[model samples]
Target: MAKHDLDPNYLDPNYEPVVNRSGNHPFHEVLAARLQRRSVMKGTVGAALASLMGVTLVGCSSDDDDDAADSADSSGGSASAATELGFKAIPVSTANQVVVPEGYSAVPFLPWGTPITGAYPEFQADASNTGAEQEQQVGMHHDGLHFFPIDQKAGGNSSTEGLLVMNHEYINQDALHPNGATAAADNLGVRPEDEVRKEIAAHGVSVVHIKQDSNGTWDLVFGSPFNRRITGGTEMDIRGPLRGYCKLVTRFSPSATETRGTLNNCSMGPTPWGTYLAAEENWHGYFANSEVNPPREQTRHGVGSSSRYDWELAAGGADAYVRFDVTPGLGDPDTDYRNEANTYGYMVEIDPFTPEAKPQKRTALGRFGHEGVIFAPAVEGKPVVCYSGDDSRFEYIYKFVSSQPYSAATAGGYLLDEGTLYVARFNDDGTGEWLSLSLEDDDFAAKVTAANGSMVGDINFTGFADQADVLLNTRLAADIAGATPMDRPEWGAVDPNTGEVYFTLTNNSQRTEGQTDAANPIAENRTGHIIRWSEAGGDHAATSFDWDIFVFAGEQGTETVVDGEAVVTLDDDNIFNSPDGLWFDYNGRLWIQTDGSDAAPYQNNMMLAANPVTREIKRFFVGPVGCEVTGVVTTPDVKTMFVNIQHPEVDWPFGTEGDHPRDATVIVTRDDGGVVGA
Candidate 1:
């Protein structure tokens, strides 16, 4: 792939600046305000600096005064006793029951069938949940969440009273309704309107207020003022170079000023400015189409596949289901829903604090099967940086650094106005470069622009109009710009202590024996691995970076067996496979979550906590059968951690009575647990 030359003109001088809040409020005030009711004791300055930089840094303190208090504890006492917070594992059985350790318990902060809006009838287990009704109810399959403290004055880790934002990745049709999805019936040629509505409602995200009692049990405040559900039906603004672009125009919002809600919101991120970044993944399978009358710009955008679902053929399908087809039809681009596909894919930002605020689809981040977005710590007058991964075989990883410095004052609104988007190109020599994807660069244009002055060539540029268009169609832009293909890149995080960016390249089965190369050294990478790269000189905005494999997924010891026989083994560590969700806790502990492929000896999906610098990892907890451990977050105080357990053993012969399926969030904390990863 040819490297694109940087275009200085693409740099927007008039870009909005990031707001910084560090100086406006005292350090303690900022921490207290952000943490809310969470009890926060003063830690060493090193810990504060590490958290501020967005890197994982750990510090242990010894105080003789606490020894007397420690001896009275049930777990026994010693200097090392301070580090051992007795955490009990809760087993949430298929009965929709939440199990936890002896001293701890679990409750539904928000369940799967709660109502959200629009007079939707109460969710019925036996009756069909219409698409519209589904849209008005709580979405299914909750995953990856964070608790934002509602009260600015609340202190300590128990400041559990806050807004809980969770991702509703996708719905299980068989378990969602009394009967399976109407769209799945053999007699059902196309998806019904109700089914489409239900599917749409199941996408995107949910935010609700939650509080814990004096006993440390958590519960949701139903219909709280801050409780908001953002689904496929929500109104969202298109921001960045693609805003108002013709390619995005649709009949619903002819001007392209706004569009419907986000879809497939998987793992997510929380902004320093108090908003949530929900990622859209596995979006390609929603629409259905025929080659004969393909959308006018279908080929242009690389969505030439026949509809993945035949929703367009059902009653009221054209209006709801057909929009996903993306084939251009009669009527002006602004007057038809053909361009609806162009609206999705970007990272949608929502203010959990403001229920009525319009969600913004940040085109600057570039579009793909986004797994999650994580930020690097922001310094005064320094760029705010974030990293993302495209969760697909042979896709790519991306990073975005805001062009403007962050300020707490201006950070509240539209802080994502402008930024530099770069794609990672892992080299054979364990080095990587952040390839610029900005539209202003000549090299980018030369590669992206058609020879005849069209936005796309015979290859179909996907009918993009400008830079915003390019951003919305980021995958295509990256392809045209020659970004390196990767193996199923997933979640990523920037170490607040060391400034290193870590991402998961979850297995790529397409790689064959002879196709092995130094950059992607392993072929048939079933077990996957974690890759870490450091920006040049620890600078987030730098174009070049160094890279290395932090840990290879598989079992530990000599010739480890995968299933019944030995497939691969790790001499250094004993671990599980398919690393998925990842996050760095407040104390700089790297939490790694796993998914899929339970090799025979392996019991179940699990989560791990690691010391990144030492590359030492230990299994923290495992999930029940047929569940993936994903979307992990720790409260500001780090005493509590939340890990999402999604779709436990979803298979065939679905039923709602005895065989009904349930997905919920699990809160993990030590029985006598102090700060997590301590």
Candidate 2:
């Protein structure tokens, strides 16, 4: 199978999203004039305007290298007062267990396959869990998560006891199946139905009530009414524009207003009104279309010809596993699962406090492989703006600005339904614009590009007549809007003090030397970088803003320099790469987590803390081998922290080498019980 078949997002993100980079494209001259630049991309850094449209022709350069090097050495921590951090920075490690600063401690909790409620089934220690047993247990490969304070303390948001809600991005069957998975099930030439069932049950989100006692220790409260599991088979409501699209009609819900299950939930966000935004990334992996002519949408998103685990092969039995087959069979629309894939790829919201409430797919946020959603600080009557990233290479960054001013009394999900979705076009010259994807306001001119990618002329591509049309095909809408594609955008973090949005552009190995943008200045960008932007006039609803490279993540010895000066030098205090997950603690400290290669220069993935204002990054915690250092949440008091380790290659936290190492959340707290980072 082609690499794009495994994951469509793996393709080059540096590919110019607009058609004609060769300068001969018809839209080049006309559309260039149509793009109303809010600013001339003028900045002290250089003539960044040349690379603003992702194909800047000018040779832009910066001369702050010597000034930055004179400011701080890589061996030192941030130029800011990062030394005030409660603990010393820990070195990278490839150990079988998690590593924290000397003054901090890590306690593992809620490992996958562990029963959260119901009959209280023991995690089939012998790897003998049935499909039903797995359902009652915690899902696998934990990713983005949050802690909802159930009963809280006065004058604050921190709660000693709360509901812990998290997303299980994908399953790690090696630790799930007794002997692991195999594709060669010759029983009628299909994958074993039982194996497929176990995997399906292991995907989705988990909610459990947890308590931190007077001793500052934390543990799960099993059998609590609030403790529940949301699997890929769980029913969900398809809300907003994409809900009623004719293309979304499936056998499961002929009304096209509902869908079954949420899978590949990667990163997430906590709504101001207290709902969980569990984003579905890599959702296209679950579907396998066997149709001779797959829908263009499916083809664009990389829905495969066969299931990732061949779940479609069990079609002879029941529809339990049949939904994975999105192919348009001979059956009528009311009896086939053809449009099932359309139902996913949106942000699914769950109310942890109300376990009985149905999970909602907020389509107004638009769709793609949503790495996550991050809302700017809320103002009661101000328009609420939420930002999200399309996780594939060359995918655009997006935002949903509510059309109605936010009301504390209004529900978060409904506010999402009536909003304007916009795609970002970042100019190299510090300034960026948000292109409207709304049909009434969107730009539909498509600079025609041949199959070979040469620009032909300014041609009209896809057009929309309503909000649904614009949102249902969000990627196409952004493409028509001429949004600049980025390098695998992952999680985003908003500065509590400034409301600036920072997103991690996870490394893209596909970006070759020939493919380079001013912002994405590196080839094969093995070490990803963080990009930060401030909304115009401090308004999230604004269409344009200023942006710059916050910091280039790399190893200690690697000196990233430009214009006769050192841009960034990674050293012992902060040597990391591939920034993926990002969040801000109450004190205005930004925490960065990595999902980089786990090898020599990098023994393991790590989580780092940075002074966003000072651009100082400090290594805080490192995870066990084979695990991605992802998902983090801190108590308002900053006393207790929750960080997740996913898909560990070693049986860490559980025991020594032989024990089954399941992905789990680990609680980090100052041993002295002082405020974290105090």
Candidate 3:
């Protein structure tokens, strides 16, 4: 569907401020003036502000050259016909049915119990899947994924052969066994290590190879050479600023030389260099506390009794169980893994090309519940910029500006090291400032030291040990630097052709009533909007930038009448709430995905596609009952698209009469058999 035509009344350029009865503050006044100016802009203010900031905003010129190079590398073939470019919606209901658009067919490749790595018994649907057994089997709840062609010479589109790297964000606890997870009480003080180990093993990432059959169906290559699993218990090396910092040390690895496993592998990104950047989200719920009080260091990190998870109370619990506990264990900080919490929350980079390579947790990018990382258009001799969001209430949006300029010779090399992290401060007046969270700044350190007293330093003191330390504890640094708190930032993408950055501000219910402000203008922002910003001078590394609300969420007609009279508003144009998953396809078409928990008015989550440059948007597909549409990736040809459906019907009562589990990945292709969004 096309966007609603803009009305003339809303286009008035000379409109003045309509004073509200509410009392004014200096912050509000500045914000009001900014919003007034933004209402008149046709495009982002980032480009114009770039000149003032003395940074260059990379634009269409660079992208044009990249596109030319990509074209030259491809075999000369006419673009796929429109009929071959269409997308078919698949209905994967809880009844275990996989539906596809007419004329297209689908086959289930790997189910929950399929064997991948060891000599394990074939999955028994009716039997309990042990933690150790689950480790040997395929992970549950497949989420974000990418299909990489094994041979680049064969073209990077979806082929009959290649390696598929998919993230199993989490497992469905209810579906873990024949019945459900065995409670500590039920187990009678005899917690099975295998059970806990199985759960941990299921929590990371899975890599497999698949081959398209002559009949056009896809199936897993059972024992493919590249197939591997990175679980929570696997050994991984520590990299970045905090690599060998005292806080990251533990009894298991006294020098902090290495750590065990990666968990909560959510949405991911693949660098040009072929490494995978997996984001860690919701990792706070894994630890627990003992009956007795723990050490001072644990409390220092906010790992107190109330902060612990239920799993900690289980039998056989100790340092292994307490490691998840943020509570400082007694004795030296290095004595236990209480400090281990500091290690997680950073982006873990894994070289899928080399399975033996230790995954590096790039600390240059500040840490938090990183939703995903999207790279800006790479420019020769210019620093590469990557955008990320802290996916939590009142968190901040961040960007990493690499210290080294882009060199084709090292395009896929180790450039993740040595970069500056900047958090966004979006102003109401369409302008924004990227505040640096640098260790060199004394003021920044003082603020952090005050909030987190464990940090030892003064206003004039640079307390950070190094860059890795800053990245590992990014949230602390961001708070000290006073970054703007956004609603809930998720996936972000940069328009290849226009160089505009689009990020999702997922809904925040706590923002109701008292939290209303100029930048966050609405109370109870249930339907989150998409925010776009251009770097000053078109450079991703600029300190200052300009931004604006590209879209606002709400019911289609609910916003048409503000104060009982019809007024032109953004809510009328492509109004959809809680924009979550986002990506830019090779064709430069912007795809917007939604994840709404509120069900009454909105039946289920959905996905939409838009042309940001033209403001043209359409509702492309809607998901089945109770699911979040996440982790979207498109082939280089833009002909095939893969979207993930995560935790469908998550709230259904456990063991209830009507409960049903929904989780799987479905392929969407056109009914006319054409490329998607052609």
Candidate 4:
């Protein structure tokens, strides 16, 4: 969530190290196989080889084509993919403002610190709001979001009004405090108690009632009952395998059934039964462990000697702030906070419709740096299926299949609490299998034994003690299962029209030529690629699937190297890098967003619309300088879309150049009042 400088040192909160020492098969060879398969499909090796080098299979046309293709139903539900992308591709820009198509409007909404509840404290541009006051305002750095209709029972599609619920991934410390943090610039001194509290309060999710007027203007409903803030200090119930595990036993929750706060939430998903699943990402940097050889759970996750922010070093050393220190003391496990970090890194289920309900951390989903989670369409009598990617270099992608059949009337978070978490093994031959991580399964245990006998790395292939241990150290379990190590797998989305799943492998510059595979074909992949897969027999719970590369991000006229040679390149209209946010509208338009470097032809982060059937992509919108364009959704009517711009370098949307830039939501709509992107 922090500025991704891609540093290897653990000092930066956002630096995700290559902790995977699994020595599994590299994804590079898989790329070669895919090339061979395409060649055979073309019926001529030479012609297909030549065409592959050009890599124009997925073309980006600059022309403003308005061909009516396919579209979904009016309710944003599954329908024929017959709608064509009607907008002209916008050019890349570095200016400190949002740019959209000719017939669209981009308006800023819900900037950080806006009051939504309690005493309705006003936002202070100078950053002088107290921690208590911040609790009543929207949290900072908005990420994944959804618009829940005001009246849920009435088909849940009210475009006029709804509750906008979104995650505040993290805080911009420099702009959060009156004069930056109370600690030294390098963060060396003890932090003031209130400043630490405010920082914690700014790191969760915000739920506020929002509405649209007849003039097409939108604003928050002041003091609505649905308005609420879930911060790092809010108490949450723990469910699934790790609920009462000893490793989760901390002083605050001695019973190990509850924990305080959710941190570093990234992308999100909605349950079929109408709930929000906020994913916790990059949370390992929040805790510090002083032990010379910390437990595998802490060390494996890259929990270092010092935390990103020294909340544990707060002046008063209250229990609330001291819990950030995971260093074990002379006291017993229940007497300290060593296991506090174990309570995080799960998909937290929040019921926005019920403001009084406590959020539940669904542990059935494996614990890792979850970029996001997306569920497959729920079938009345079939088990629920979902996919999540661990957003770390060379980490594995995971899937959770619920044990109970999905029933529309009875579905809830309880189904998520009982499931089997599996890691993906993307074979070089294009076929992939799901490796079970469930400790109760005999086959998985045998695989662990085999890996232990042959393993040769810093990681000890010790067998898992129970399901709780496996879920707590999910990466380790994945390692033993021989899951394919990908190139920093991030957000994933499932196509509503076809059950295919797509994921953005946000760039991994560390990958070498030798590590490149069919799935991750590029060497030193500065510009990432998108990969999609179809489940066997159209079964979401199937153990196998077929995958292929969808698109590779690069600049026009520049050589994009793969396996030590130039093979793929992009065109002017859709040149981009580091694809992060991905989504699919009901009409099946695949929306792709970038969080790339502000270098060369691509000046700022942008979003693009892709026609999945035709393999055509076109630029849609561009954000201000140094801002990551993410979190997108459309009203059921498809007339309006909401996207978030986070941590802009320049002051924007209401601030002068000298003032601090604030993260806010951008509202996009059509001037002619037609469906957006069509």
The models' CA-based lDDT, in order, is: 0.61, 0.72, 0.59, 0.80
Residues 1-678, candidate 1, lDDT per residue (tens digit)?
A: 000112221111111111111111111222222221222112111011111112221111111234224322311222233233234322222332333445643333345666655563576656466666766666777777877878642333345778778888876665665655554345445555666667677777888777777787877675677777788778889887678787778888877878877877778888877778998776554544445645423432335444333445556555655677665567788656666877777788888878898999987787777888888877778888888887876567888888788886666435566888887766544456787787677766666655224433244334446666567656656655556666578888877777888888777666575754322334465667677778899888888887655655654332311122322223222346778888877666788887757544345777766655534345566666677777877677776777777776642122344334666667766667566555
Off by over 4 Å in 1: 1-109, 115-133, 152-158, 184-190, 292-309, 442-465, 517-523, 558-573, 650-656
In model 1, the worst 10-residue window by lDDT is 13-22
Candidate 3: where are CA atoms >4 Å away?
A: 1-33, 37-109, 153-158, 289-322, 411-413, 441-469, 517-522, 558-575, 650-662
- List ranges where model 2 is wrong by over 4 Å: 1-84, 152-156, 182-184, 442-466, 516-522, 560-563, 656-659
| C-alpha positional error of residue 243 in candidate 4 after TM-score superposition, expressed in Å | 0.4
Return the lDDT, model 1, position 672.
Answer: 75
Worst 10 residues of 3 by lDDT: 44-53
In model 3, the Cα lDDT at residue 567 comes to: 25
Instruction: Report lDDT (Cα) of residue 56, candidate 1.
Output: 22
Q: In what order do the candidates fall by lDDT, top score first?
A: 4, 2, 1, 3
lDDT of 2 by residue, 533-609 (tens): 88899888999997766666665444533433333445667767778999988887889999877875667999988
Residues 1-678, candidate 3, lDDT per residue (tens digit)?
000112221111111111111121222233345432222211211001111121211111112134323322321222223212233332222332333445643333455556777665466655465666777776766666777777742335555566667777766555555555555555664445555666677777777777767755666787666677788777777765666778778877788867777766677777755667888765544544453654332222223343212445446775455466555567786776666766677677876656677777775676677887888878889887888887776667888888788886666535776777888876655678887787666666565566553432112323456655566656656656767766678889888766889998776666455755534455565766677878888877888887765555555333222123222222222345678888888777778887775354444677766655434355565665666667777555654566777666642312222232535566666555555775
* lDDT accuracy of residue 333 in candidate 2: 79
TM-scores for candidates 1 onward, in order: 0.78, 0.86, 0.79, 0.91
| Predicted model with the maximum lDDT | 4
lDDT for predicted candidate 4 compared with the true structure: 0.80
List, in order, the clash count of every candidate structure: 50, 9, 41, 15
